[model samples]
Target: MKKTAFIFPGQGSQYIGMGKDFYDTYACSKEMIDLAGKVSGIDMYHLLFEENQELDITKYTQIAMLADELAVLKAVEEKGFSSTVNAGLSLGEYAALVASGVMTPEDAFKIVVKRGAYMQEAVPTGGAMTAVMGLDNETIEKICQETEGIVSVANYNCPGQTVITGEEGAVSAAADALKAAGAKRCVPLKVSGPFHSDMLKEAGLKLEKELEQVEIHDIQTPYITNVTADYVTNKNEIRGLLKDQISSSVRWQQTIERMIDDGVEVFIEIGPKKSLCGFMKKINKEVSAYHVDKIEDLDVLVKELSGQE
Candidate 1:
C-alpha cells in the first residue's frame, strides 16, 4: 500500500490570482471563495486578482492564501483522494485543520482573518524577516544570541536554511554575524511583521482569546502541528498549540521528518506553489513528492494518482 501525506504551504508561497483557474472550473472552488469573502468581509476575487500589488497587506495575504489552499483541497477531495496524515506551515495549519474536519471552513476563515490582523498589529511597521542559508540551526542560534537586539530564529525551514525575524537593526546585525560565521547568504524577506517571535506574544494572546470562542474537534486525519512538530489528536491540545504557534518558531523540518517516520512515502503539496515539495526533497530525497497547483497540474495529478498516465 502507498502511504501518502498531504502538506500545505505557508505565507510566502502565495501569489496573485491563485486558484482563479480552479474557481472557473469547479463549482466547489467558487463556493469556497464565496464563503471566504462572506466570513472575512473582504472581496476575495478583488483582493486576489484586481487589487493593486501594493495592497498585498499581511491580513489580505493571509486570507487569500487560506482561500486558495482550501479551494484546492476541495477540488482534491472531490476527486475521492484522501491522506494518511496532513500538515501545514504557519497559516497553512488552519487549512490543514479544515481539511481534517477539525473546524469548518467558515470558522477557519474568521480565525485566520483575526490571526493575521493581530499579527500585523503586534509589530510596528518596518519589522522584517530574513533567510540565513548555508548555516546550521546551532550556528544561527549562536548568531541570534550574539546579536544585541530583538532578533530570533523564526522558521527552522530545512537543513542549511533558517529564517530570523525581529527589529530591523537586530536582524541586520544577525545577518552580518551569520555571514561572518560562513553563511552563504542572508536575504531579507518582504513581509509586514516579525512573525513567529516573542514580538508576536501580544498577538498570540489576543488570538488565544479568539480561539477560545471557536469550537475545535478531533481531526478525522492526524494533523501535525507546527509548534511542537508532532501529531496532535486532542481538540484542546490543538487549540493551545495554535495559540503558541503565533509566537514560536515553525518547526517545519521536524514536522516533515516525523511524517516520513510515520510511513509517509509520498507527499502531495496542494497549494499555489511547489514550496513544500522543494522542502520535502531537501529533507529526504528518497520520498516521492508532487505538487498540484494549476488546472493542468491537477489533471496531471489525477491521472498519475489513478495510474492512468
Candidate 2:
C-alpha cells in the first residue's frame, strides 16, 4: 500500500446526529455505537440521535465524538481499508489508539468516559483560549512570554494559526500583543476550559491513576502523539505520554510535518467533520487528503485510493 495515515479530529467538530447514517447502514457501526453506550453507560445512541442538550457538554461531547469516529472507522475497516499509520487531534487520539490496535474498543470507551469527566472536573473558571491567525509562531511565542500571567501556547494548529490559552485577562492581553505584533486576527474560542495548558495538569494526574486500571495491548500500527509529535513505539510509554498530553501543547503542525517527511502521501480524515482535512490543506496541499463521514464518502475514498495503491 502507499504510505498513508488516518487522521481524526478532536472536539469543536462534533454535531448532533453525526454518525446516524453509518449506524443505520452498517451492522458493525451499529454494534460499535451500542458498545460505547454499553461500556460507558452514557446512553450514547440517545445522546447522538435523540434530542439531548448534553451533546455540547464537555463530559458528553468527548465520548460522543469518539463513538462517532469509531463507528465510521468500523465501516471503513470493514471495507478492507487500512493505513500505514494513524493520528488524532486530541480527544480523537482515543479513536486513533483503537484504530492502531494499541487499545481495544471496549477499553477506549471506558477510558474516554472517565477522561471526559476528569477534564470536565478540572475545567477552572476564568480561563480562555484565543486563535492567533496570520501570524508566525515565533511572534506568538514571544508575545506569550512577554505577557504576565498563566498564558502560553496551547495548540500549534497549522502554519499561520496558533491557539493560546490561560487566564482570561492574560489571554486578552496576549491577544492585544499579538495584534500589535502584526497578527491578522485574534479570535476567542468558545470552549469550556483552557485546554492544552498547564491548567489541566490536575486532570492528567487523575487520568494517570485511572489508566493504570486499564490494559494496553501490543501496538500493531504506530501513531503520532500530539504532545511530542512523534510516533509511539513502545506500549509502556503510552500511560506517561497520555498523562502529560493533557496539559502540554498540542503539536499538531509538527505531527503532520513529521508524517509528510516520512513519506505519508495520503491522509484520510475520519470523523464528524472535515476539520483535519482543512488543516491538511494548510500543512501540505500537494499531499492528497480525504474525509470519510458517510457511507458515500467511504465509497469515494475507496475509488480514489484504488488507483493510487
Among the numbered candidates, top lDDT falls to 2
lDDT of 2 by residue, 80-129 (tens): 88999999998989999999998999999888898899999999999999
TM-score for each predicted model, relative to the true structure: 0.97, 0.98
Model 2 lDDT, full chain set: 0.92
lDDT of 1 by residue, 216-294 (tens): 9777988899998998867788777888998899999999999889888988888988988887778999998989888
> Candidate 2, 305: how far from true, in Å?
1.5
Clashing pairs in 1: none
Q: What's the lDDT for residue 120 in model 1? A: 75
Model 1: residue 133 alpha-carbon error in angstroms: 0.6
What's the residue-level lDDT of 36 in candidate 2?
A: 90
Say which candidate scores most in TM-score.
2
lDDT of each: 0.88, 0.92
